[model samples]
Target chain A: MKRRRPFLLFTLLAFGYAFLYVPIISLIVYSFNVSRLVTVWGGFSTRWYGELLHNDQILSAAWLSLRIATMNATLSVILGTLAAITLVRFGKFRGRTLFSTMVSAPLVMPDVILGLASLLLFVTMEHLIGWPAGRGITTITLAHITFSAAFVTVVVQSRLSQFDISLEEAAMDLGARPWKVFLLITLPIIAPSLLAGWLLAFTLSLDDLVIASFVAGPGATTLPMVVYSSVRLGVSPQINALATLIVATVTLCILLAGWLMHRQETLRRRAPVIDIS
Target chain B: MTTRATINGSARNAGEWLGDLLTGHHGRRLVIALPYLWLLVFFMLPFVIVLKISLAEVLLGRPPYSPLWQYLEDSTVQIQLHLDNYRRLWEDPLYFIAYLKSLKIAGISTLVCLLLGYPMAYAIARTRDSLRNLLLMLVILPFWTSFLIRVYAWIGILKSNGLLNNLLLALGVIDHPLALLHTDFAVYLGIVYSYLPFMVLPLYATLSRMDLTLLEAAADLGCRPWKAFLRVTLPLSLPGIIAGCMLVFIPAVGEFVIPDLLGGPDSLMIGKVLWTEFFSNRDWPAASAVAVVMLVLLVVPLALFQRAQEKSEGKPPL
Candidate 1:
């Protein structure tokens, strides 16, 4: 029975990983197919990659998406770090429940609802104050920041909550002000989490299609928006090339992050202990 | 004391007061207020607008919703509230069925994810440290990839002349290509594939943290392995199960990309319904009403998920 259980588990694990990966592997292989049809491979070629590069619509959309993602990630990291600090450091502030709820609620909120509501809000704001003027990059970035900040807050909050308070207190004891202590002691300790949060927000903003579709105006087409429109017309080799590029880039980033983390671990272990005695 | 006196004396100037408020003792308040106000304006205020728009009549104008209130010539306010949008949702079986169908699909998908994910998570949790980390990274690696790309990959596999059909035909498993794409089954496959990581991560977390000694004690007490797992591991992992299920179910219910890309015309999910109402049909009021109703349906589970999250704040969530 014991041997059978391990075998069952191993099989299940193998199947699970295969289920997750096989489609991606097949898609990667087909990206190089010379034929227009996805099923038939007419030898290998880089023609689709060349075509993708020349597609003006896709290029512009990718540029717009990159800009929006950069802006969203930067703003989300700031707001998320503040929200995390509030939740972790502030002890029993007024409206704390509501504050925490507002911070976390966006994580599970449906994209359709969030999109519809945000679009309505932008319209109402425009009608009332005429601040935004119209929906475009600004509106989509704002919408992305709102939800992405929630995810960032979760990431930062977990790290902050586990942090030791004595480090900050020690900095304060050495005559550093509260802000200085936070900047010098607290921020450095939690910088890794902040980076993770930033990357997460960047990816989320870049990948969003539904919310961006709702909040975006005529000119501001994101990469996902362009991809969705083209994908609806059925699978194309260009999209496959684009997908392959995205998958490869992301995999490379993850591997780089993993290697950096491992090196950091080794460096920390090798550091000489302070002779406090 | 001298610095405080000087600061109080300088507080007569607005710039000094503002600077003091930002960099001085009120820094804590600034930290709390910034994100608090951002969410209030962007996240919370939008829901109020949705509720307001849901009560307004659909109009053929720029914003596409009639005014809820207007000042008459006599300066008396006339309030116009049209509940027809909500009423239409009730009268029209399409909206009702879509909600039901979304719930059914999300529920079934969540269950399938749990069944498939639980064992994998358990296996990973039981592995040695280095292998476990590698396995966990493998689960998260797909999650970091583009969601649209993942869903799009299935189209190439599920279409009539797709890879799966071709492979099956070559193996002589089927005489003809079976209809796979644009089906309810395809939607299920997409949801399970996409959300499987969300289920596994949380389950792995709680399962890894579980006390294995209790299982050993159960076995020593003459309990069979299955019986010990039922009593010890399964019950112990209930929180993870709930967390994992909610993570999968909440998003799956309102999932737009998966259903739209993979589902056929007959597959009526509320997210697609809402999308069509807003984008294709250009019915803002109706879409707002649909969103408000969907929010109402999800509020309880969302609150429960938050409570669980608050209870486990130090632990990271996927």
Candidate 2:
């Protein structure tokens, strides 16, 4: 029984994973179907992709989403980096506990509540300051930044935890200004983690449906919103085609990230040992 | 020269004092505090707003507007605050029933994920060193795909005449295609598909970190393989089980997409209700109330779980 256990376990594991991915594989395969109804597989055709290309609404929504995601990702990284640095280095100050909790709250808080509260915030900010005057891509991007930064902060914090403080101290001792030390020594080491965090933020913002729906105003529909509305109309081959492309792109990115991380780990392991005389 | 030395001495004193202030137990407190503040402001504050709105009446499109004293004047308001929503919720049996249904669906899905993910995580963890990283990476490959697209893919698989049915029919197993789409079963399947990786990763973390010495010792004592696992391994992995449950259950309860996409019209999870109130109905007050109640229901249990874990571990809960 013990000898067969591992093999049994592997089979079960493989089956479970296959269950997870097969639906996705099916969707991708059927995206090329010429048939409109989901049942029959007509001869393979790229008509859906052709239709998607000319659909101005979908293209514009995609562009808007891309712009917002890019902005949100960049802003999230900057703010998250600052927050992570402060949390790690400053360690303790007045209301530190409160700040820590607030930062993490976004992670577990229901998306519906977050979206509603953010919409409320945007409206209130408009009333008070008469700035960010309208709800559109700007407000939506701002909202995404709030939660996405929280996520980035978590990743950056974990990365920073494993980092040594002495690297900064050594730079400072070698006649480098604080900014210079951060730029030269600290930033490079944490670059991969920062990149990872940015990617995470970007994907989250891009994938966001509930929050984006809440904050979006006229002319700010995203790819998710489009897909959601279209799904309501009924699942079509166009959506399958879109999903296949997204899944393919993301899978490629994940593979690249995995390879890059592995290379970095191996390089770190093989780094020449310094002998202190 | 004397002044300069004195100034330098004082500066050095201040630096040491700062260092002392943040060292040892005090340092851990400080390190943990920032996260606490963040949760308090963003997480705690939103709930506070929800609670405040839940109490007040719907005047216009905005949340409640009643002053605290005015609210107090109606003695009904005191107890009515809680009763108002609960009464409203009770009046609509649909809401309560939906909650129960959602809980049942989420609960079963979490269990399914545990069964599937535990073996997968174990297999990956027990793999040879060279293949371990590759296997683990493959396991998480789906997560990088957009969540929406992944869920969207399910429509093709679960539809009436979809892939599963097509394949089954070709094999001559059944004369008719099974009704698989727009069912509670489909909802559960979607949820488990999405959340399985979450359970696997945590279990993997704990399992890989597990020391083999105890298991070896148990085996040496002539315990059967299963008996050794029960006595030595299972007990050590309870923490991971709890963590995985929390990770799956918390978000699963609030999930909107899976149910909306896969579930039939009768499927009415609180998340979808909340969305409908906000978007379709445009009743902001009612939506806020629902959002408030859901948060309360969710947070109380989670807090209790955290407290329980803390008590067991004999540490303050993070």
Candidate 3:
């Protein structure tokens, strides 16, 4: 493969990554610009960072977003784990096709359609059943769960399918109850993936704008909604500050996850060799 | 003694059967029913409602639509059907134009992502295992950040006095700061930048799994590198190319963020149109009609493609 000219390959990777990172790096740098003008940088200052802290609307929205995301992630995990287990554990059951189809439906569905459809559902259900009397945080969270559950299901299901089931069988053979087998043997083994799925859902919910906008009422502004409305006016250094903070936090988390994953990989490799010996 | 043993065996069989009844396929099926039922109630039912609303009259009311039924008695009801929403959608040139423009933009963006992502995915796929892991991680790590933030970052780069224009001005590429911010070009850039990862990951999946021996054989037979690539690599990686394109194109068609933020008012994507009609015009039925029409335009071809792919791959139809 190296016999083919490798120069072009290196150039493409360089340009591609430069395209991806330069915009982000510039955004971070401009966050500290002293001047109010975003395009030109005066000397470095933390004015925007200070401003961001004092902005109560953004702060409250961020808090609400965090609360909703936490709840959404938790619900998504529980529901997603259930769906994954069903698809993996149940064999040729009734409505299997519909279950699988619905599980993956939201992955590619347009947000406009999804949001519209769900909003319509809430409206009719509100009028007919008098449950969820209005769309707000509850409706938003449920709507978030509807799509994020699909994401969680995809993640957990893949991990579940790859899982070894003989351990559960062995536990069952030893007179463990069915629920006990699931509790002790299955859940623990897939816990890491469930964590990953939860994190994915959390990020997705936190970042969402379009779907949330559709379902959210006046009082239910999320962080993204606040940022979006602000951006519509003009780019602000405060938003840059927020973006920089988000990028840093995400980068740190990913690095930590990568390191942990690498360590686990090495441990698994070593343990297998020890067993063979 | 034989009769006593036989009786004991039969008794144990009955106990096992009862245990199976309590903790068997039937019980597991009920456990499975929970999420399935949740989706049936929430996900599928909403589409039904959307469909219902699309066929109803938009009115100023609590729910903002006329109900399909008027109860005259316990068993008698009147059914009212409205086709004006559909008819209006058919007559409106704006809706049709938005659909065409969306397809064009999405198609071009998919092409651009392919052009950029192919080489990157190829390079990563061809790298050694350790390097490949790191490269793949780098490609994916940015996605963990807020998508809105990522798109926002582009404003600083694409604005008149922003990074790209300033750099070009400094280099004397052009005398004036170009109108790079609010145009089809910016929209293209936004879509390509946002969706490049979607393209690369799928392509990498396919490319890495490719049997390199075929390429080696072609090389040994004195085939030129580019020809070998076309004959061997391209054909083998068609699945990835298709997957990546569909992933980018389908979502791009209904994309609201990029066009709303980056593209000018005339951008006219169906998503933006639907939103304006609902929020500004307060036309629930019209918006619903637009959504229904958009779903048809997007879903039907994809459904056909999915069925074809599943058949070819020998997977379960679902």
Please name the candidate that would achieve the greatest DockQ relative to the true structure: 1
The CAPRI category of model 1 is: medium
- Tens-digit per-residue lDDT, B1-318, candidate 2: 999999999997776566555443574465455445444544455566656555655555333333232446546553334336556876898788877876787788889888888888888877878988877876677766778778877877778778788888899998899998888888988899888877887678677778987777787788887898787777787766766666677678878998999898877788888888777877665777777677767775465445333332311111
Where does candidate 3 stray beyond 4 Å?
A1-5, A165-181, A272-277, B1-23, B73-75, B217-224, B304-318
Candidate no. 1 TM-score: 0.94
Residue clash pairs of candidate 1? none
**Model 3 per-residue lDDT at B131:** 90
Q: What CAPRI grade goes to candidate 2?
A: acceptable
| lDDT of all predictions | 0.90, 0.74, 0.83
What's model 3's overall lDDT? 0.83
Question: What lDDT is reached at residue A115 by model 3?
Answer: 84
* Residue-level error in angstroms, candidate 2, position A257: 2.1
Find the 10 residues in a row with the least total lDDT in model 1 chain B: B12-21
Please give the range of 10 consecutive residues that has the lowest summed lDDT in model 3 chain B. B309-318
TM-score of each: 0.94, 0.84, 0.90
Deviation (Å) of B230 in candidate 2: 2.4
Regions more than 4 Å wrong, model 2: A1-5, A86-97, A164-181, A269-277, B1-44, B59-86, B304-318
Order of the predicted models by lDDT, top scorer first: 1, 3, 2
At residue A58, give the lDDT of candidate 2: 80
Considering DockQ, where higher is better, how would the candidates rank from best to worst? 1, 3, 2
